[model samples]
Target: MTSTPGERERRTSERVIALLMLLIHTRHGYTTAQIRRHVEGYAELGDEAFEKAFQRDRALLEDIGVPLSLEQPEDADARHVVDASALLLPEIDFSGAERRALLHAREVWSETRLQTEVMRAVGLLVDPGSAGEADDGLGLPRVVQRLTPNLEVFLDAAVEQQVLAFGYRTAAGAVSPQDRPRRVRIWSALEIGGAWYAAGWDLDRQGERLFRVSRVIGRPEELPGTGSDAPARPADWNPVEIRDRLLGQGEGLRDRVRLWVAPGRGHSVRLRGQAVTPTAQDGAAPGEGWELWETDRPAHDGLVQLCGGLMGVVQPSAADPDVVAEVLAAWRRVAEVHDGAPPPHPELAKPRQSRYRQGQRERVSRLLDIVGLANRAGGITKVELADRLELSPKALDADLRDLQYCGLPERLFPGWLFDVDAESDVVEVRQAVDLPAPIRLSLPEAHRLSAALDTVAQMPHADDEVAPAAVTAAARIRQVLADVGHTGATTSVRPSTGGTDDPGDAAAVVPSAADGGGAGGHEPPATPVTSFWDVHADQDTVRVLMDAVARHRVVRLRYHALHSDRTTEREVEPVQLVQSGVVLYLQGHCRTAGAMRTFRVERISAVEPTGEIAKARRRPKKTMLTPVDTTLEAVLAWHHRIRDLADDYAPRLEAQDADGRRLTRLGLLSEDAAIALAGMHAGDVEVLEPAELRQAVRDRALAALRRLETAVRL
Candidate 1:
């Protein structure tokens, strides 16, 4: 079976290239006959051999992130064309400055075990030479290792919303006792402030708690699972915030306290807003060493240790009779809390896991959002879908594949999973077989879905049967929320803007509507709110406008123009609704203006769909927000002493001289912005800009220096 040296390798390479070229060159899909006739290697193979080869090649192409599709031929006589988008390797879009940043990153990453893999990936994605240039020869040791195995397992379970049974090791090295299972519905696996922590409702504790992945004694065993019991993550849960709260790691005052510290040495505390003054004490020396310090009682143990040298209880006074009683009362409460328990292992209390797994939540959330959107739209075009999701076509395809592979445990069958169909020019997705019946819902999603169903019932020509079913579904959702202890959950429904109607009446299904078909003699289905509008939006108006936009329909609006200072009614073909800051603006082609205009949602007092569908037109990609001017450029020269600041603040390296001085160009909007930036990073940044800006910064610095000198004299 041995061939000439490199013959086999060369053949595969040539075939791969030839196959790519064939796929790229063909606009219309090529059938098996066309592929055999056109592709170089396929022509030489026999029927069965070609079948195996074609399948392998197609699979290989897809494995490398190519968007390949298989579809039934339109004509039964024709073989299926392997429909695929042209495979173009993504161009490295790193700017010169970004490249330099990556080069610095490469230097940092090179010290790790990931060095080889990172370099290989970088070489494949971008040029290796560019990545290797300007190595900052400071060889720092790797501090972060690859994610621990337990962290990965926890992350996988969290994404699937599965319950895991595991033996967690306590700080005392005691593992979970046998016979009793510790089951938890993993809410999230997070790396906050560089450590990994997995949080969830501890089925055993009946309350939420976190665990350190590193302290997990053994592999977490997946419990026999059902979707119904998936616990809700806390409503106001932020991994970092939760971790900080749980660890009691913040600067806060517990009680008013005063201390006397070594004078001048207490500047650290004084700088933190503590009032400091020379103490009135019985001392022989005129210039005493001790100074009175009054501040909030330092909350953290570290802060307590820092204040240990100080004379304590100055405010309460050690002589106060109640101080002893207060101390005893505090001790009694502590004794009651920790009476007979070996304190929960320190690891259990403060999980010190790595943060590499933090983005898992975002990935799962995005996947669900995509699925939900696709289900509502029935199908969406690939380009539009990508734009809505803010992803590249290639990235979309990759994520789709990820989605296709994700689902409930029952998704072992192909039909159970979400399916993508891109046979035609437009790509469509078949929603997962097990949607509308998921294991659990994030609270916000449940509320949103409930509101959407209510909106759907209000639409003209909506079936009566839909209302009762929707009501039942909404009740079940509320029950689910209740089951998860979210008792006071309310529907975030907004009123209809077309008419002055009660918000409650808006949710009630109407018995009948005036039956009149529009120009096409077909009544459009009522619009439902799809996009989560800004918090300040008139939900009713936004719903109507978004509905019109989705159906390519026109809407009549009573809008008050800020410039005109007048309210006028006008018909607009709602193109899209965009959010900027706290305001939602409807960007549409105005019949009155005869051009595309963006109207603030608040100004639009009324909205009524005009029943007329708009002719398809290309939407403007540009938004109303003007791009910030980065015209004010500065060349910052930094001394070697300020190398760390230079690394942090510099946008691009302009030059580095023999004396270890670095010059960097910083693009800014105005002198004010530059001044603010330089002031924030004062001493580290030397601005050499439009002489005026430089002079202003210099003057500000001198003024500050003069103030300090004056204070010293006083």
Candidate 2:
């Protein structure tokens, strides 16, 4: 009978563990012939099978950071030995504050792809029993950072020093069949401004370049040769500084630019600029009145592009005719695009395949932990072992059985490395193994820990407490990894703070000038950086809300509703914080509205505790955070160009039009939301059903055009 995948995996695990235990237990190590003759799995295999299995097991051990060394005596078969000292993680004492800060930093990646790695790293470093349960009182907002599909490809390339080739799209262009292909030797990978970026030496250009992960047109393939043929990364290389130099080339206006804003709109603009007194000379006011704001222009073409996106609400002052003309031109282009027939959907980039199975790595990690845990306890009960490791009884039994077969060849050693007394419900090691101490951190694990520490270090903290501790802890870990020859793993990639001028400002969405092609088929000037939405919320606001929630207090909020284009004040009983994609939401029972509501953290203009204790109430059922009710649904047709956004709506594809537009039914919270969605991606998205929504989108677009014309002629 053919063995199942489970049996194969168990056999592989047993063989690898047995080899490791044998090498560590015997100082002189074992030759291949001796290992094959003695190891249980190898003894049962044919000569050809034994060779492949032995080689695979050896590679697996080395890949996971096991310090396995090969030694050859003259005219003798090579011997594989485990460097016990090098395999152990060095002892680094952490202070109380540092420990708390480190734990908190680890918590930030709670639900992210890196969570498992972060947890494993923490488990190895901190004594779980002594490290008091992560303080839940603070209720830190959970951050969900989505890794780009190509991130692993780049990471592996960097670590292995390999060359990679991929199709790359520039900031000004979408992914197309005619995309320019580029080859690179990846030096580092980092996340900045909520977007992942790979920095490396462009092989074709013979210069360093940075490429946005999302802009990669297709899967990156590894080139045959290693990066050893290319120049090494500079000693002073810093991805952040290099990215800034490359992207921040242009200068902004030296003086402040005057802007007229409609009431309750342009919050992102307002937050950056100061409100100015509007005069009669400012021209005709729209809505209640045009609020005049003057703020320093951002670097490059950011100011123009920023104002262009807020055409209906924001207008540049006539004092600068050039700026006004540019804004007007942008508005006209948007209007023309909306008026024109929808363009065919752009070709979407193919999702890259992950290099390895996460489950496989996790399983290996669990097995290693078992050995370390069992060794530390001298002998642990099976029930206690299962509970501690969070494993089912069956799994525990299976692992024990695998461990029982792992040892020196039966001829060399009479018994297995680990002896399990199933009847007594006890697991004990019969022979000494160097694995009692935690193994060195793997490259991926180190990267995750480094990234998490970088995030915590950047966050705002009271008295600047946690930030300093995080920075110190990161440096210590980096040094430890480097000392252990894990230099590649120590490369830290920090997620940028949205590149905002004001640190306190929440992540804002600045529309790309090239989003809508202009009239006459003219391409807009390339943006300094690709448009990206930051996922991190304002730390100050999140901290206050968390406090209120912990105290069970009623809080007053000044929230700006995007769909309605209005700000409202309401009292709410703080409940929990929820993170979905690039948006953070505060889910609570709204006392003012007498209903459960989810408020976007970015839209919350102000949060103040009312000092009123909230009444006891049952927690609301967990639901996805959306602006509107799910019961009301809207049918929309969106071109594949904006498929990423469409995918967020849990869309059911009804049909595809000739233009490659997909008709999808999506849930809507309100009519205004449907209109806002269509208007935001106008020309790319159309309201297919609910005739009223289509008309509303048209009216909004026309009104915006009229407003732009009025502002231009002033």
Candidate 3:
């Protein structure tokens, strides 16, 4: 009888497992004829079918990192053998602090693309039952940084010392022609000011250069046989220094400028500067409750970024006569870009592909992990084993049956390589088949672990008494990978500490000067040092709030609400700190309002302990962490050029226009947020529906323009 597709796959899998077991367990390897005779499912196949199946299975095993090799005897056919020493990871015994650090890294990447890889890597070290129970992030501040596909490609290439070819966009937002792809050997890649960057040897230029990752036109391609020819990275290469030099920061003339800030606004800016009495020479007389503040900043471009980011709320003083004009010009440039027509074609569209193959790889990884886990436990209950592997009882039974077929040839040995006692309540592996330890980390897994640990290193520890566990753990893991010939780009990429200094700047959504202009020649205003992962809260405030959350204490907060432009003092029962997009929030029950509320951590100016234990309250549901309100919706239109930005809203594609612009429906939480989102992309995005929202965006831009005009007259 012909077998069904599922049955055929199962048979193939069992045959492969048996073949691997025989090769790994036997001292003198097995020849082709011996393998077919002993491995299950192989003897049932015809000569042609068996040859095809054996070749495919051998390739699969090698693809999954099984170091399979062939040995030739003096007077016999070649024998296939598995290289056990190269396949297993060296045993590592982690300390309490190191284990906690690993757990923290896992939590940080839980929602990212690296989640699966990171979880599997951590699983190799911690007990499956206890891994989920650790409160690793209890007293630590959290910062979520996004890793783009291009960034990951560059990271891998940096490790392998490969030369890359890709189209690059200038700071003015013009993409180089395809034929003129920039060739570079990346020495280092890193995150600075929330943007990803790579510093490398520009082959065409024959000198060191930095490329902002966001400006890369398309997926980079590796040049054939180029890594070996590239020069070694300089011993003293520093990514930070390269970034500062390229951006013209840290070595410029400084100027003291006064600003008129509106009340309850610019809280972050307030922290950086001091309040001053209003003076006639500063600008037009302050309106209503506006107050004057003074700050010393780098001249010209830096001043423009600071004032432009604070836009309407901040007016430059006469101390720097050209500062106001420069800021106004920058805004006009951005406005011009917004008012232009859409691009003829989309520039940065991401490829959407099925993840079926990825799922298959993960399953193979799990199977290998199970071997190590069962061997280490000696014997474990079937239910416990199923739970640990996240498989149903039926699925676990199938896996066990497959293992039963994997063993030495009957002529060579008496029993199977693995004695899986499925009939009993307990499942035990009597023979390990030389796979008692977990496999070495893959390149992607190593990069994810390194990046996650880098974020953990940047986080402020809640308790001063505790040592820096992340730093120590990172060093140990790096050494292990290095010893095994896996050199990942760990030292290159890292999280940035720079953030928007003005609280009002959160509302400012201008494009980076380094980004490309949409469809027109107009460029965006130079934005303040901001990251794609916008972290607004001060480190000290985060530390205090995290400590309070850990202790379950009631704290008083002086928060400035961006929607209402009001500053209010309230007592809140700290519950959990959550991150939504680039913004971090404190979810808790507010004693002052007598209700549950979510507060933006950045807008909070002061946090003081109320000297009272938090009252017993039900925790908010997981859905509450989402910032968007799905009930409200808006229609938006944008050229394919900004598909990356449009995808952020998880919009539904509505239709396509003749101009190659896409009409998409997006859910909105508030009108202000929608406006900010549109303004942030300049004119790349258009609000097609919700006439009120469209008007609101126009009104906001006009108001800012009027303010700029008035400042110019002063």
Candidate with maximal lDDT: 2
- TM-scores for the candidates: 0.31, 0.79, 0.75
Which of 2 and 3 is ahead in TM-score?
2
lDDT of 2 by residue, 268-359 (tens): 56755798786655655554667888876643345644564454667776567777676655545444545534444333332343243455
Q: What is the lDDT of candidate 3?
A: 0.60
* Number of clashes recorded per candidate: 6, 3, 6
- What TM-score, to 2 decimals, does candidate 3 have? 0.75
lDDT (tens digit, per residue) of candidate 1 on 1-714: 879744554455445434543453355555667777666567779999999988877765553334466555557444433333223222335544333333322222211222322232232233334533332212111122334457656755654456888876543234577667578876666432223457666776666666656557567888765424445554444443442343333335244444444444444344333654433331111124545555544332323222321112111222222432343233233223222322111111222333443132334434554554455455656666564445578867766765554442221222433466534335445644323211133443333333333322322211223324434444454565555554332232321111110111110001001111010122111111111111224545655765676577888988764322345789998776654322356777899989877777656767898889989566665554321346677666554333323332325435654444456665665665555444433233456545666666655444433332332233
Model 3 agreement with the true structure over 1-714: per-residue lDDT tens digits: 988976766556656666776787766888999888877677889999999988988977765557688999899999998877777766667666666667766655423445556767776666545533334455453334344557767766666567899887654345567989988877555544344566666776665666766568789999967645445565444443443443333355345677778777755457457998866667664357877788766322445555544556666655456766665565564455445343343222333431313343565566666677777666667777775555678878877776665555444565655677768778777666466666666654665575566555555456432226655666677777667666533343232322211111111122222221011121111111112222445667777887788778889999876544467899999878875443467878898889778897767878989888865465554525434546557777764444434544566445656554567776777776666556544555677666666666666666776775675466
Where does the lowest 10-residue lDDT sum fall in candidate 3? 521-530
TM-score of 1: 0.31
Which is the better candidate, 1 or 2, if ranked by lDDT?
2
lDDT agreement with native, every candidate: 0.44, 0.61, 0.60
Q: CA shift at 360, candidate 3, in angstroms? A: 2.5
* After superposition, candidate 1 runs with Cα above 4 Å error: 1-89, 97-149, 155-163, 170-175, 201-207, 222-228, 231-237, 247-257, 262-275, 278-289, 294-300, 305-714
